[model samples]
Target: MNITESIKFNKLKEENEALKEQLEMAHYFNQNLGKELDKLKQQILYKEDFDVLAEMYYDYCLKDNSKYDKLLSKEGE
Candidate 1:
């Protein structure tokens, strides 16, 4: 190849390598985010269960419906 052609080929090769590195990084990030999302989902389930138990206690033990009513109000909002 001419000098000019060789220079262009080297530049293109560098760009290709850079793009491969970027793709690998993206794949790693996606996997990490997926794991985080799974953890968040488990946390949400725990929270929902706790909320239900608390509401039951408020309604039956305390005989107060105000908090439950407020919860419903917040849901609407």
Candidate 2:
């Protein structure tokens, strides 16, 4: 190849190598992001389950207090 053509080819080859490295890094970053998204979805589901259970427990406590008050009144009398 002529001198100018050879220089251009070498520069192009270097650029290609740099682009490949960047592509690999982006793929790896995307995979990790996918994993993190899955984890976040699971955490949200767990939080929803916990919130439902807490609400149920609170409702039960409110209902039970009435019965407890009767027992206390009986004991005092």
Candidate 3:
């Protein structure tokens, strides 16, 4: 190839390599974001379950609802 052609080919090759690297980085970021979202979903589910259990305890085991109210107020503070 002529010198100009060789230079153009090298430039294209470098651009291709740069694009591949960017794609790899984007894939890695997407995977990590998915993992973090899963963790957040699990935490929300856990919190819902715990809230249900707490409500059941307050409704059945406790004679006075005032204790539950106090706990709620403490949390707000």
Candidate 4:
């Protein structure tokens, strides 16, 4: 090969390696972003269901604690 061709070949080889590295990084980023997207979708789909469940648990705790309060008051009798 001519001297000029050798130099051009080396430069292209380096550029190819750099491009491959960039492509790998992009793939990793895409995988992570896809996972995050799935989680957000789940939250959007079930937000109301989760809210209702949390409210039910909160109400049960409040009622149970109030019953304990009544017991304590009666004990002071």
Q: What is the C-alpha RMSD of each candidate to the true structure, in Å?
A: 5.2, 14.3, 6.8, 12.9
Query: What lDDT tens digits, residue by residue, belong to model 1 across residues 1-77?
Result: 99999999999999999999999999999999999999975553333444678787876454675554443322333
The positional error of residue 21 in candidate 4, measured at the CA in angstroms, is: 0.5
Q: Which candidate leads in TM-score? A: 3
Give one digit per residue, the lDDT tens place, for model 2 in 18-69: 9999999999999999999999755533334444677878764344545434
lDDT assessment of candidate 1: 0.73
Count of steric clashes across candidates, in order: 0, 0, 0, 0
In model 2, the number of clashes is 0
Worst ten in a row by lDDT for model 3:
68-77
Error of 4 at 14 (Å): 0.2
The lDDT values for all models are: 0.73, 0.70, 0.73, 0.70
Candidate 1 is scored at a TM of 0.60
**Residue 5 of candidate 4: its Cα lDDT?**
100
The alpha-carbon deviation from the true structure for residue 27 of candidate 2, after best TM-score superposition, in angstroms, is: 0.6
Candidate 4 residues lying further than 4 Å off, grouped into runs, are: 45-77
Worst 10 residues of 1 by lDDT: 68-77
How do all models score by TM-score? 0.60, 0.60, 0.61, 0.57
- Reference-based lDDT, residue 15, model 2: 100
Alpha-carbon deviation at 70 in model 3, angstroms: 20
Which lDDT tens digits does candidate 3 get at residues 1-77? 99999999999999999999999999999999999999975553333444678887876454675545444322333
Error of 3 at 15 (Å): 0.7
